[model samples]
Target: MNTDLMINRGIIKYNGNAFEEIDDVIANEYPLTIIVDGDEFATMVCTPDHLDELVIGFLASEGIIRAIEDIAALSINEDRGFAYVELVQKQTMSKDFFSKRFIGSCCGKSRQFYLHNDVKTAKTFMKQIEISVSQCFNLMTKMQEQSTAFQLTGGLHNASLCTKDQVLLSRSDIGRHNALDKIYGYCLKNKLSITDMMIAFSGRISSEVLLKVSKIGVGIVLSKSAPTTLAVNLANDLGITAIGFVRGQSLNVYSHPERIVS
Candidate 1:
């Protein structure tokens, strides 16, 4: 299925004076219901591409699956917009999934408090991957150039896994978290080591974003937008190098500045 559609030609008004008919590419959004071992998991509204990766990534991030081996089988029916994931071990659903929280593109509804021990044990990344400032800027540039969906619809978030010089993988979705999940799923399925990798995102850096990066043991995150105060604090606690507002040749290092060489 196509991820975007050129639905209709419409007259676009500019500057309140001139108008022209233009073909608009609209990004597709749909509800993808995930079923884990016949139990209905959460349904997410996202773009249709990379459904398998999204499912695997979501399960992994939720701590439902500790490793790729935990997933026994996976099937995605795009026609029905459902993903069936069978795990090797039956797991209990997280309480957060059933709580009443307003889920957003960046942060989910619940405000989770992480204990120091919990952060240190499960999510803290202590990798020593140092990237130059120029490399950070260049990685952001590569991510931007690879965001074909965003350029086509101007209504999608892009995320990428990268090294110091090149983007290894990129994914797009209407939700920021979904884009990152797609990348996560891809890496996990391929057994790629994320310890020394960095993530470049075209969205605001939020606490949830930090958690996702931490879950995959990625050491750095770069964003073309701002970082929330809580996100910065979490990055510090998680030992992640968080850089935001990356444009052209400028960026603001929010945490662990030592990771970005001069």
Candidate 2:
């Protein structure tokens, strides 16, 4: 379905001059409530596009569902801010899913209060691709260049998971975390894995970004900015490689420097 809506507004100049009315691009935002097996899960405020992908990705990222086949059916009531997802019979949720809170923070930073010492790695040796500095530059440039919303509003962040061949999924939102979630959702609905995939973002590397990557077992993370201290520590702990300041042919390796050849 076409998700774009149109609005008309007068362009006001910095000099207090108003130009003729023009059509402007507008996306839809609404409250989305997710329901699992007749139980109310969580509600999020998001753009009204890709509802199926959003809910599935949200559950998978939260560790609520392990695989695409685990989801039986999903129905969305766009007018009611609700979605009902029925899981396949006999599937059980991990105990950790009940304890982890659904975070809507722009950075999706994992809460310190919820850190479990017992949490162990769910994946091993996620990526084996040999990447060069120029490849990193091309990826970021492509990710940024594909952000249509950011070009229109100048107020959006973008996230994408790409391969050596092409971009797999890319999303944009007013919040950086939301963009990343959208990309994750896209992957989950499509039954893709973060293993050996490169995640690129147009935001700062915070604990939240690290948590998102860690949850999906993504091997390498590239950002067109800087990372926080906590994010670095988490990346090191999770065996996930992180790269920041990914501009041109240079980047800063905050953790797991071995992943980047040059």
Top candidate when judged by lDDT against the true structure? 1
TM-score of each: 0.86, 0.80
Model 1, span 129-233: residue lDDT tens: 899989988999899998876787788899999988899999889999999889988988999877578899999998878878887778899999999988887
Which ranges of candidate 1 are over 4 A from the true structure?
1-21, 93-112, 115-122
C-alpha local distance difference test of each model? 0.81, 0.70
Steric overlap count per candidate: 0, 2
The true-versus-predicted C-alpha distance at residue 99 of model 2, in Å, is 5.1
Error of 2 at 95 (Å): 10
Q: What are the C-alpha RMSDs, in order, of all predicted structures?
A: 5.0, 5.2
lDDT of 2 by residue, 86-156 (tens): 98863355444656544433354333323331142233334556666777788888888888776666656
User: Lowest summed-lDDT stretch of 10 residues in model 1?
Assistant: 109-118
